[model samples]
Target: MPRKKANETKTYVLDTNILLHEPLAFLSFQEHDVVVPMTVLEELDYIKDSKKDVARDARISIRSMEDVLHDATPEQMTEGVTLAGRGSGITAPSGKFSIFSDLELPEDHHVFTSNENDNRIINAALYLQEQKSPGQVVLVTKDINMRLKAKGAGLAHVEDYRTDQLISDIKYLSKGYHTFEGRFWERVKSVESRAEGRDTVHTIAKNILPEAYINEFILDESGEFAGLVESINEDSLEILDLGVERLMSRHAWGINPKNVPQAMALHALLDPHIDLVILTGPAGSGKTLLALAAALEMVVEKNMYDKIIVTRSTPEIAESIGFLPGTEEEKMAPWLAAITDSLEVLHKNDENVKGSMNYIMEKANIQFKSVNFMRGRSIQNAIVILDESQNLTASQLKTIITRCGEGTKLICSGNLAQIDSNYLSAVTSGLTYLVEKFKNFSGSATLNLDGVVRSRLADFAERHL
Candidate 1:
């Protein structure tokens, strides 16, 4: 596929994961000078030390340069790939993106490798800023907060690496159903009514938010209810009320009116056609439960969706694996345990379901695989639920979302403030990050899931904790 070129001419220095954003991300830098800091290379070396998955991801990133960069020979590469920056060249040129190697980490002199390495890489870009101070020395990073700290330190310009944003907010998305926005009430009155009676109520309901109910009539010029009733789900919204209705339809197991998240889930379930759906909320909220119900209704009851796939971010749980030594699955036991608890809650040890559950575990479903396994494959027709998505880097989220196949539905649910991903905060974590970006596209919907449907104790924790 021909890469869509960016018209901008800023100098974009990438943190390691930015290099990992699908092939097109790198190629998109057509006329720009892309910088790969030496510290990032050091970090990749350490990352590749973990598992075959990390090693494989590292290779994919390196291969992105196959069309443009070349290897530096002994005479040239004496300093390494960073210093001897020549890889196979095949790009439009005005001086290619420079690999600025030779930066130092004050701590290890080992040239920053971990988070320490990420800091040093941006430090190198700062050094570059001192040297060239170009139009905008933008450092594109998936490290949510790195961009912030970098800006605070001195890199004046920092932007998200999102070529595409995940559709998260319901109002903004190009829904399956067309909506008459409240914003249109003013203009539509000027231009004739773009939408008729029922649409007017849906539009007003969207404006009011939550469960929409109003006594006002949708009158024509003659001032009447227009001989039609404008009724919305006092508990749930009609599928036709969504900008993304084609993806959502009336399923036998409907979303509960009290469960506002259900209102959001229907959008995800209805859109079996949509491959990725990000649903986020705090603890005590029914993010996981709602997801399970949707999967059951679609896969078991309706036979629309294929399989139920569930995973979560392993950031906070990485330490547990350090104590248990074995294959990666054994290592990830603690993180994946949360999903198991949810599964247990769903099945409660039913023999008929146990077999399929065991298969999911052996095959990496229950205990089968980690997000690392999801990278290369195009997951299809399956309901992929990523709980606690807040702990993922934007790049990590991108990798997960792109892994979806033609008939897949990905549900990403997490509380923005509750993230464990290094350097990520409420605004920058993967959950909210995907939400803010893709809130306005076709076949995509995101629900912030405001109300806590769990017990009072759990709700109190999310509120105060």
Candidate 2:
């Protein structure tokens, strides 16, 4: 246990959403006294038996909490139990874990009523603030409104749980590329060229683009040059030259690039050497369309992979999926409609559109799956298209990414602006985490499709709205 200093150790009261967002969140506070409000426990108990996706997380959180406090006596439960040897790194095993019973707060003592769970949690924080006296008491939650209410009710310290947030602002996130104004050669004082098969590799000074990473694209205003950063050394870098004309003419299952960003995205998606491709952009930037096209081409035309697996997270997937009677694919159809829509767009000009769609579906062996059922499966030799990835947390994405076995390629695509999860933001999203973490990996590539090519209205809305 960490040595306690007078009035320096804080008591952090955790809300239910924090545990739901991350099952082991309680262990993150180092050397601090962690308190779980009784109201939060009740909410977890109620949600544990439900069919929601978070039900499993609730069970895990309960198990983790019980494992820490199971042997504690009734009096010890009210006091804090030592959290030593339970966690590591950002998770401090030196903290004290306890449960706070806010329901016993008298009417005169309570600042907020115990009728609602949020209010009750707030009252618990207020109670701790008074009880702890000179020490600090903070309400840590992912809910914005709850934080506001806690502060309004006279709780001095309130903070959003930010252990998983890798970046503070979305603008600091990598766009997978760097653009040099005018000619890129003008800045390059010297270079060494070599031919490796059909591709030409160029060695240049690292100062030319010191911030470049592996598989990152390099472009210029003149539109004459485009290169991929293949390797980075101590004082220099190696780039694989990909001419602009060649990138623009690249095709994937009859879909052509409409812009340079799209061209680079298609290039990354088509490369068999790249195992993971992350696409991020605004709505109507063709993230899904490009991913689907590349998957179809690689699976059907190129015969690179045996099948295509498509999955995404939906709010109602867990609760409504089981109640809606059908096979796994049929039950997942509603959520995977975006994939089918892209297939139609790909084969729209065929003689028989439905026949072509059915033929391609069979030929490629496309499978629609739910994020809820992706656990404990070793997937191999397939192209996995994970759409709407911005809504996923880093741990949730890790669960799916680790399932990819040998010869598997995972394409993660999402719009950071369209995050639907209450606890997630553009910078804290799993997509952002994946891009930043894998940018240095040689087998991964990221592309930020810049334009809204769906229609004129989409372009205008993306800019103005």
- lDDT (Cα, tens digit) per residue for candidate 1, span 1-465: 565253345677888766544433554454566777767666666765655334556666666554344655534332223311332455433435455664543443332355576668667767666665435577888776787778877777777665544443434432222223344234232211234554532323333334222211122232211211134444422222332232223343334534423454554545555555666656767677667666766776677766767776665445334466788766666667666665665666677677756654443333235676677888777778887788776767888889877777787877765766555555546666676656544456665566787788877877787
lDDT of each: 0.57, 0.91
Best-performing candidate as measured by lDDT: 2
Predicted candidate 2 versus true structure: per-residue lDDT over 331-378, tens digit per residue: 888888888999999999999999999999999999998888898999
- In angstroms, the error of model 1 at 208 is 13
- Which ranges of candidate 2 are over 4 A from the true structure? 1-4, 88-91
Off by over 4 Å in 1: 1-39, 52-57, 65-67, 71-95, 101-257, 267-275, 316-333, 343-368, 378-381, 423-441
Please give the lDDT score for candidate 1: 0.57
RMSD for each of the candidates? 9.5, 1.9
Assess the local accuracy of residue 166 in candidate 1 as a C-alpha lDDT between 0 and 100. 46
The TM-score, computed over Cα atoms with residue i paired to residue i, of candidate 2 is 0.95
